[model samples]
Target: MSLQAPPRLLQLAGQSLLRDEAVAIPAVKELPRELFPQLFMEAFTKRQRKVLTAMVQAWPFICLPLGSLMLTPELETLRAVLDGLDVLLAQKVRPSGWKLQVLDLREVDENFWSVWSGAPVSSSLAMSQRQTGEDCPCTGRQGCLKVVVDFCFGFPDIVLQEFLMHVCEWAQQRKELVHLCCKQLVLSVRYVNEVRKFLEMMDLNCIQDIEVHTYREMDSLEQFLPYLIQMKNVRKIMFRHFPGCIYCSPRIGAEIMWELISTFRKLDKLQKLHLDMVNFFKNHLQQLVRFLKNPLVSFTITGCWISESQMDRLFLSPSIHQLKELDLTGTILSDFNPEPFQILLEEVAATLEVLILEDCWITDSQLNVILPALSRCHQIISFNFCGNQISKSVLENLLRHTVRLERLNSVIFPVPLECYGDNFDHIYWERFVQLRAWLMEILRETQALRKPEVILLCTLPCLTCGSRASYDLEPSPCSCGKLGREP
Candidate 1:
C-alpha cells in the first residue's frame, strides 16, 4: 500500500507556501506540472484506474506561509482549500498562520475631501473586509461599518481620506489584530471624519507594529497623529512613500517634524520605527536632534535633501548610538559640498553595525575618509554599496578597513567565471579572472566578518520614495548586531 498524496496549491512566501497575507501575498498561479505533476502523472500512469488514489498518495503543493499577515478571499480561499487537504493527508507540513483581513471600502462621504488633498498611504486595505448584514468581530457593528469609502483610487479626493479612513476602519477592528503591522490606506479626505471616529476607539495598549506611509500634506498627517500615539501596543511603525509620488521634490515642512516627535512621544510600548524621507530643513534639525535622543533599534532616512543643521542633528542626536541598523541611501550628499558626507560617516560610522548605501554619489575619496572611523565598530557585520561609482582601489581599501564585516556586496568580493575553462571566451575570461582575482585577494585578506547574505535597496529616494507620495519620514530600528552579510 503506497502512502497517500496531499492536495497542493501555489503561493509566494519564504518557501512558496500555500498562502500569506494580501499585503504580502503574491498573485497565485497553478503549480507547474513539469516537476511535481509529471512525476505524479507517471507514477499513476500504471494505475489509471486509481488516478485519484495516486494523487491522494503524493504531496501535491508548495508551502510559503506568512504567519501574521492577512490575505484576501481570492488568495486565501485557494490556500485554505489546499491547507485543509494537507491536514486530511497527515503529511509533515507547517501551514502559514496568516488569516484573511480584507478591508472593504465601498461607501462615501465627499464633502471633506475638498479640504484635504494628496495623502500618502498603504497600497492595500487598512481594515478588514466589510459587507452588509455582517456583525463586527471586534466591536460587533452590524449592518453599518460607520465609515464608508471616501475616495476612489486615482481621484484627488482619494488622497484626502486615504490615511484617515483606512486608519479609522483599521482601528475599529483593533481587537482582532493580536499581531501588529504598520499599515494604512488613505484614498480620500471625505473619510477624515471616519478617522476622527477611529480615535474614539483608541486602546494604546492594543496597538502594535504599525506601518504608515507619509504623504505631502503639511497639516493632514499632523492632524491625525494624536490617534496614532494612543495605540500602546504599536512596537514598530513603518513610514513608506505613497504610491503615486515618484519624481516630486524631496523637501518637507516644519509641521511634519513637530508632529513626528509628538507621535513618537505617545508610543510607550514602541521599540522600532521605520521613517523614510523626512527632509531636513535648517530650522527643523534642532527638533530632530532632540527627537533622536529617544531609544530606538532601526532608523532609515531615505531620499531627502538635508540642510547642514539637519545633517548635524543626525550625528548629534544620540539616537545613532542606540540603533543597530542604519540605512542612509537615496539622500543627497549635498551636491553642494562633500564635507557633510564626511561628517555623516563620522557620525554614524562607528555605531552602525548594519550599513546600507546603494547608488549613492559617495566616491572612493569619500569612503576612504569615512570607513576608517568604523574601525572601532567591531559589531559591523553587513555592508552593501551596490551600483557605486567607487573605483576598485577604493573598494579594495574599504575591504581592508572593515574588520568584522561579514556580509559585503558590489566591490566586496569578485566571482570567477567558468569561461576560464572554455576555449571560445577564454581570452576575455582570462582578463576578467585576473582582475576579479585581485579583488578577491583583498576580500580574503581583510578577513572581514563572514555573514551569508545582504540586500540592496538603496536607490535615490526621489526614485525609491514615490514622487506623488512624498510622505517623508526617518526610519529607525532597535535591532541588534551588524548590518548585512556577503551574498
Candidate 2:
C-alpha cells in the first residue's frame, strides 16, 4: 500500500507555498480569519516561537499584536515580527487598498501578562528590549492615512517602557512623516509616569486631540500638567474614568478634580471639554468658564454632582455666555433650584442650540421655572429631558413654549406617570396623544412656512406592576379603560 501524506503537513505546505507567492492574500473576511488571534494566543502559550513568527508573517494586514509578539520564546521571533510589520507597513500596493489602522497596545500590562503566562517579569523585560529598526514604509508617503494607538490605564511599567522605546525608534527613523501623521495621542491617568515618558517623546504641538481615561481613583495627575499646557493646537480634550457615586467622596474627588481643572487654563484653542465620571464642586466650576479661547463651544459633564450654588455660578459665568451646547446629564439637581439654569438658558438663547438634562430629577416646579427662558431660546434645536419627574401639564407647557422656536427640531421627554398612592394607574396615554397632536399641528403649520420635521421621543411607562418604571416607548394599560385615541 502507498503511504499517504499527513494531513497536517499538507496544510503546512499549502500555507508555506501561499506565503512564498508574490500575491498570497488570504481571505481577509472569511470565518476562519477569526481564529487567527486565538491561534496566536495558543502559539504563545505553547512557547512555539517559530510558529508564532510564521503566523505573524502570514498575517494579511499589519495588526501587529505587540503583547503576543513580546511573549515569543525566541528573541529572533520578536525581531522577525517587528521586521515583518515594518515590511508590510512599507508596502503601498494590495488587492484592496486597506492599510494598518489600529496599533492596540492596551494589552501591554506587565503584571497581568506575567500572571497569565507564569513568567518572571525581569526575564520578560530583558528579552523584549528592542533595538532601533529601519523606518516605516508608509513613512515619507504622501497620503491621508492615520493610526489610532490605544494607551489606556492599567498597563504595567515595563510594557510602557518598551512601547515608548519602540515609539522613539519609529520617530527617529521617520520624524517628519510621523510628525505630520501622528496628530492624535491617547493617554491614561492610571499609568502617569509611563504617560509622562511617552509624552516626552512625542511632539505635543502636532497633537490635535488628547483622549485621557482612568479606571480608578488617582490621587494626582500633575505629571501631565506641563505637556498639556503646551498643546496649543489641541481643539478637543476628553477626560473619562470609571463612574463613582455622584455624592460620595467629596473631599478626595475635589482635589484631583482641581488638578484636572487647573490644566485647562492655558489651552487657548480648547473649544470642547468632555468630562465623565468626574466630581465637581462650586470652586472648580469657573475653570470651565475661564476657557476663553473662542467661548467654550461645547461642555458635557456626566455622572457628576454639582451643588445648586455651583450651577448658579456656571450658568451666569460670562466666559460661557456665548456657549452653543451644554449637557448636564446624569447630574443630581436635587435642590430643585432653577434660577441658575434659567439664567444660563436666557444668556445663551441665541447661541445655545442644544440642551440636555437627562436623569436630572427635574420636578414640575423646576420645569416651570425654566419654561419662560427655555421658550425664548429660539436657537435651541435639540433638548433632552428624559428621566425626570415632571407631570403632563408641565410637558404640555414645555411643548407650547418650544413650538414657536423656529429652530426647534428634536425633543426627548420623560413619560408622565398617572399614579395614585404609590401605585401606577396608567401612563397618561391621552395626555401624551394630545401633546403629540399639538406638536404635529405645530409641524404642519411650520411646513406651510417651509420648516423641517420635528422629531419627538417619549419615554415608555411600566406595563409590569407599574410603579415608577424604566424607559421604553410602549403605552401601558390605563385604569380609565379608554383607548388612547382621539374621540
Q: How would you encode candidate 2's per-residue C-alpha lDDT over 116-215 as one tens digit per residue?
A: 2345675544323321111333444553222323333335456555655665566456544343223556666656774565666655665566777654
TM-score of candidate 2 relative to the true fold: 0.60
C-alpha RMSD between model 2 and the true structure: 12.1
Measured by TM-score, the strongest candidate is 2
* Candidate 1 lDDT tens digits, 1-487: 8986543322112123212223212222232332333332332222221222323223333211211112212232223323433333343343242222222233322112111122343422221221321222233432111222222222354433354444444435443331122222332222344455444544434345555544555355556566666665566666655546554424556566677666676566555655565443334544543554356667666665666556655555655556677776666552434455456456665455676665455665666666666555555666656435455566556556653444333222211222122422112335443555664565466544553343222212222222111100221211221111111
TM-score attained by model 1: 0.51
Candidate 1, residue 1: Cα displacement in angstroms equals 19
After superposition on all C-alphas, the RMSD of every candidate to the true structure, in Å, is: 16.5, 12.1
> Lowest-lDDT window of 10 residues in candidate 1?
468-477
